[model samples]
Target: MLGTAGKGVGGAVVWFTGLSGAGKSTLAEALLPRLKAAGKKVELLDGDIVRTHLSKGLGYSREDRDLNVARIAFVSHLLARNGVFVLVAAISPFREARDRARATIGDFVEVHVAPPLDECIKRDVKGLYERALAGQIPQFTGVNDPYEEPLAAEVTLDTSALTVAQATSRILIKLRELGYLEESELARAEAPGNAASAP
Candidate 1:
């Protein structure tokens, strides 16, 4: 169990890591408002948005990727320690950075959003996969680049098989199971109009 007594209140980092089109942002966006409604101070650090700001000018090299993940982890660690539910949606392809993040932020819940690579390709609205496959984008994750899946994630959701609502519900259940949320709040969190309005 993670310590919440001395830290003020519920402050845990719910990290969503996976391939680019694996629905990490979708789930994080779905969960954010519900967490706010539940009276938790929450912040979402999206990979694309962060890349434009925090990781500007960083290339696609392994060192750059690791540095990007490190910056996100550092921010997450600060937010989490200060009693904020930080939702990070990043590819974060390396396990080393994630392990360091878990160590840094003691109360960390890693949610690995893993779907089949083919499924991700099919769902690529941005045509990132197509471009990467065509060699237009170098070192893109899951194509020329690598995505190291989590060996033991607290929650692993296969977006290919599960509906958005179902996947979000499973994450909420995990949060409750880990004692980040109250048992009485599960139904409310999982309720249909709360966070997951999309099918």
Candidate 2:
């Protein structure tokens, strides 16, 4: 369990890593609101948002992707250290980079969002898989670039079988098991005058 000085509240960095259409972003977005409603300070750092901000000029090369992941990891670490939960949904394909991120962020929890490739292609919200298939996008992870999965991730969710709510529940259960939230917290949240009372 992690500890914070004075407040006794610790922050966790939940990294949702997988292929492009693996539902990482969707799960992260869904989980963020639930976490916030539970009185937890949470931030969602989606890959597309980070790519637009920190990695504006970077291309799809392996080196650039590594750098982009590193940058996001650094920011996530900083926020987590300040007692804010950080949710990173990114296709961090390299094992080394993800390992380095775990080392940098002490309370990092790697959640592998592994959906079947065919299922991902079938639910191509951004048409990335189609573009990759058409040779428009080169060296795509899960196509050309390798996605070295974590050997010992804290949580693994197969979105092909799990709905968004189910996946979010799994993550929340893990967070509770890790002592990130007390069992009584949610009950207190429902009580009147509590900070997390529903609107």
Q: Please provide TM-scores, in order, for all candidate models, with all chains considered together.
A: 0.92, 0.88
> How much lDDT does each candidate structure score?
0.86, 0.81
Top model number, lDDT: 1
RMSD for all candidates, in order, please: 2.4, 4.5
Q: Write the per-residue lDDT of candidate 1 for residues 1-199, one digit (tens) a residue.
A: 2233223364889999999899999999999877776777899999999999999999879899889988888888788877899999999999988887787777889999999999999999989899999999999898998888899999999999988778888888888888888866666666557858655
Instruction: Give the runs in model 1 whose Cα sits over 4 Å from its true position.
Output: 1-8
Model 2 spans with C-alpha error above 4 angstroms: 1-8, 186-199
Residue 127 C-alpha lDDT in model 1 = 95
TM-score of 1: 0.92
Clashing pairs in model 2?
none
lDDT of 1: 0.86
